[model samples]
Target: MFTDGRLLSDPGPILARVRHRGSPRAFVFAGVQRVPVVSEEVGQALKTLAPGDVQLFPVSVEDVDERFFIVNVVRVVDCIDEAGSTGVQHYAEDDPFPERAGEFRWISGLRILPEKTEGARAFMLKRFKHPIIVAEEVKEALERIGNLGVMFKRVTGNPGA
Candidate 1:
């Protein structure tokens, strides 16, 4: 639902079933698709840091009564500095999905115009919702939680470095 950047009317009961038994972290991608899921602690931090940038929906994980929420980052900023970025590829006209010709196929070492973000703390890059971009404050908050299953990459400074 979040991939489209639209507000959900009623997401219904979201269930994240556990496929493997292990200790869960404060944050973790739901599956191979990398859907962002957060524990109550992490969710509270996000709620405080970016109350307007995200919508948290309660989720039920298989066999675990612990509270969790599926993080739906609603903001999609079109601020990618394409020229300053490297290893960026857009779908070409000859590609199978011709409609996506101008859309990002993949991006490595991504860079964005911080000013163009319009002060959004947590957001997804327009046309490339796979990666979530969070401000330093948010990162710090997540780090403070300590048990993160996510990794961070700097996206706004020293492009091409």
Candidate 2:
């Protein structure tokens, strides 16, 4: 996994390549830019972050199928154990939800639905929250997989293929 601030700046190029192939489907951000924190541990792996870093993890569509349809895993770091320590907390301390740490709070999976498959589509649509920044690279990878399926069907002389 490539880790650095440059990943965020031009994720477009990396994403584009991923879209073309059905490999390296996952992408993760190691820091949350514009956030602040007291120690550097939070920003070590990530770049251009605020106070802390945010990581990204990406999974390929093909891998999901091979693994029983599990797509992605997202882990957010935003918890502090304040054992009665009266330390000065920054203004941005309240920005991240401390209640949830080491938890997969974001999108975790994506499944392919057959065309016109209302039941399947409905389920995915509900699971995927709106306003999601579905990167172009991800979209491209999925599209490539779709095209492969179509090709297989035509060649095998079976729509199910």
Candidate 3:
């Protein structure tokens, strides 16, 4: 949902205010094709994409119709502070190098279209901190999926929406 001019800034506050829960472990969104990774992985990947590029982060779930899901693309800025390092160590018990400083902060989280909702594209643009740019490859992938008529439906009452 990032617009055309707001790249290279932080999208943290907007993400924190979102009411949705993080994606559940069992309902990984990998099959969506348009969205290729888990939220954490997506955050990591954003580090390489050009700032302001729009990218969709798909979340998959069962018991919902196939036409609704969340989709949004906004600029991501990673801040790897000491607290982030602590979080990583806590999550990954077998820290590869516990003695060394852990200096890796991920995309943290991002904003996307809520499930069963429309206007996400516009919403992200308006709320995002920076101008959004859609990566050429990502845009092409979306187009390919659109041509195939692959759509998603939102699931109400789902814990991880």
Candidate-wise lDDT, in order: 0.87, 0.24, 0.32
Provide TM-scores for the models: 0.93, 0.18, 0.21
Q: Highest lDDT: give the candidate number.
A: 1
In terms of TM-score, which candidate is stronger, 1 or 3?
1
Question: How much RMSD separates candidate 1 from the native structure?
Answer: 1.5
Instruction: Tell me which residue pairs clash in candidate 1.
Output: none
For model 2, the stretches where C-alpha displacement exceeds 4 angstroms are: 1-67, 73-128, 147-161
Residue 12 lDDT (model 1)? 87
| Cα deviation of 15, candidate 1, in Å | 1.6
lDDT of 3 at 61: 41
Instruction: Tell me, by TM-score, which candidate is best.
Output: 1
Per-residue error for 3 in candidate 3, Å, reads 7.1
